[model samples]
Target: MESTGGLRERKKLRTRQAISEAAIALFLEHGYDQVSVADIAAAAEVSKRTLFAYFPTKDDLVLHRIADHEIEAARVVRGRGDGEAPLDALHRHLRARLAERDPITGLCDHPQVVAFYRLVTGTPALQSAAARYVASGEEALAAALRETTPGDGRFAEVTAALAAGQILLVQRALAAANQACIARGMSADEREPDALAEADHAFGLLSGGLAPYRR
Candidate 1:
């Protein structure tokens, strides 16, 4: 029964993937607003109800990919090795993703990945949705840090915000830069050397204490 259930879950995931891919292709070919949920449902060969079951909102169809990354920061903060600071764990994770060319880093140059990013960043609604998703991630990670790091309870929220903001801002800036370079016709591979340099520079600012300037 468990195996049967597992198979059923896998089938559902595949169907979801198919629908998402079909929706993206349609959005890329036509403008996002020009396409409707009905259009994506038809294109994916799924009923409208099926698409809605997988995706709650029209914005969700495009920005659901953003959700893939939503809890990543919180997870890293929660799961850091003994004696490892939250920021250290996050930094290490990001550097590893840079080496791995993870799509979340905007460092994957595959045509489909490029198109998906172009579609997301090019569409205003998707961009707004992505921003909110990222902000939610920051908030979640801030909560994680507040709970995990031992310190004064009174200042926890303020300190967590500072820590989370510094880390997430650096990451978002690096990804945006990579996207811009790709937009200007540079392959992720072609831009990797510079991307590495940018990461180093950005993180260095945090390590050197960016918050001091604001105070």
Candidate 2:
């Protein structure tokens, strides 16, 4: 038997999932802007206050699916193996995620994943919200890099920020390209070979350009 706390957590998860699914369905059918919090609440069979309790903002309804990845870069750097360079660790992780068809890699061709990508990219408000998430991720990655980087004071901070920006820019470009291919109806397996090659090339450039900060 599950503990009371465990059951409560499961119930909360179910409720959140229902709310998210309802929001996505409505957004896809009616346009994100056309949908209101009260509309989603009604579709999910929850009160507006209850929906707000789960997701503070309308953007959260869509972006919550990706919230787990917000600190992924920082986690990768902090948890790198002994003697592993941060960039190398990140490069390896990207390859692994690509191989797994992780949606964050933008290589997933799942109908829902493709639709979610379209929904976010096509919405100006969601694009702005997504940018905030990217900025936060970059900041976390920079902090991790600063911890592992050599030097002191402003030099380390600036270098880390520069390196993080470059790394994330590469990631974003690669993901955008992959998403484009998928949007054009290419399957993830069909795109994997090129995606892996491109990742290698991108990381190779970073390794050369960021050698000074590669700790």
Candidate 3:
């Protein structure tokens, strides 16, 4: 039964991936607004009902990664090492991501990926969806901080919220810088050296006493 369940889960995942890829290709070829669920389903060789089962809305097809980021900051803060500060953990995580050429940095300048980014950044609907995801990230960070600094209550909550806001802002700045670099025809490897420098510059402002941990 467990093996069967595992196979079922893998099949579902493959189906989801196919649907998402199909949706993105269509959205890029035609404008996102011009593309419909039925269109994506047809492209993916699936039925509309099946597509809906995987992604209830068209926005979900595009903004899926944004939705996943909500818990990430909180997890970083909560899982910091005994001697590590929350900000330091986040910094290390980001630096490592830079080294890894993480996709969030707008490193992939492939036409489809660029179109996807432009689609999200340019579209009001997708922008709103991304904003909501970021807001959820703030809440998750605050909750994680509450758990970490248990006795302080309100102070911890406020500090965590502030940190989360700054972190997200830094993220936006990094992404913007990367996007600009890519738009200028810089390769991912070519962009990283400068992008990391800019990222460090942005992050430095938030470290130390800049936004002190209130709790």
Candidate 4:
């Protein structure tokens, strides 16, 4: 049996999912620009106030799908096993995600996932919002790196910042390539081999640059 608080949280999650699914369906059918907040509220069977409580901005209704991952890299770094290098942990994590066909890795070819990717990339507002999210992730990862890396000074901070930026850049580039392949009709299973190889090569290059900070 679940606690009352657990049940309440589950109910809230259901409501949030209902609202998000409703919003995405409408956005896909009608253009994002054409759908209004009031329209989503009606479709989700919630009051405008309820919708606003879950998502403050109209852009958030879409971006919320990825909100949980905004700090993923930071979490990965912070949670890595003792004595494991940060870059190595991150590389392992990415490989595991690719194997799992996680949509965030851009290697999942599910119809809805593909559509979601297309929707975000095609919409300027979503793109802008996503950039902000990426920047936030980068900042978070940098902070994690700074905390974990040895040395205490401006130099250590700068090194962590630079390394974080490079790691994220590589990740974005690999994901973009994977997505492009999928967009071109290659199945995720078919692309997995190439994706793994690319990830290896990209992370290998990063390892050299990040050697000084390795644990």
TM-score of each predicted structure versus truth: 0.90, 0.97, 0.89, 0.95
Question: Tens digits of per-residue lDDT for model 2 on 1-215?
Answer: 88999999999999999999999999999999999999999999999999999999999999999889998999999999999999999999999999999999999999999999999999999999998889999999999998896568667788899999999999989999999999998999999999999999999999998976555
The Cα RMSD of model 3 versus the native structure comes to 2.4
Deviation from truth (RMSD, Å), model 4 = 1.4
Identify the runs in model 1 with alpha carbons over 4 angstroms from their true place. 210-215
**How are the candidates ranked when ordered by lDDT, highest leading?**
2, 4, 1, 3
lDDT of 2 at 150: 59
Q: By TM-score, who's the top model here? A: 2
Give the alpha-carbon lDDT of every model.
0.83, 0.94, 0.79, 0.91
Show model 4 residue runs off by greater than 4 Å.
1-3
Worst 10 residues of 4 by lDDT: 206-215
Question: Per-residue lDDT of 21-125 in model 3, one digit per residue for the tens?
Answer: 988888777878899888899999999999999998889999995676668878887788886777677777787877776667666667766777888888887
Query: What C-alpha lDDT does candidate 1 achieve relative to the native structure?
Result: 0.83
Q: Please give, for residues 1-215, the per-residue lDDT of candidate 4 as tens digits.
A: 88999999999999999999999999999989899999999999999999999999999999987888888999999999989878888999999999999988999999999999999889998998898888999999999998886668768888888998999889888988999999999999999999999999999888877876554
Worst 10 residues of 2 by lDDT: 149-158
**Clashing pairs for predicted structure model 2, backbone only:** none
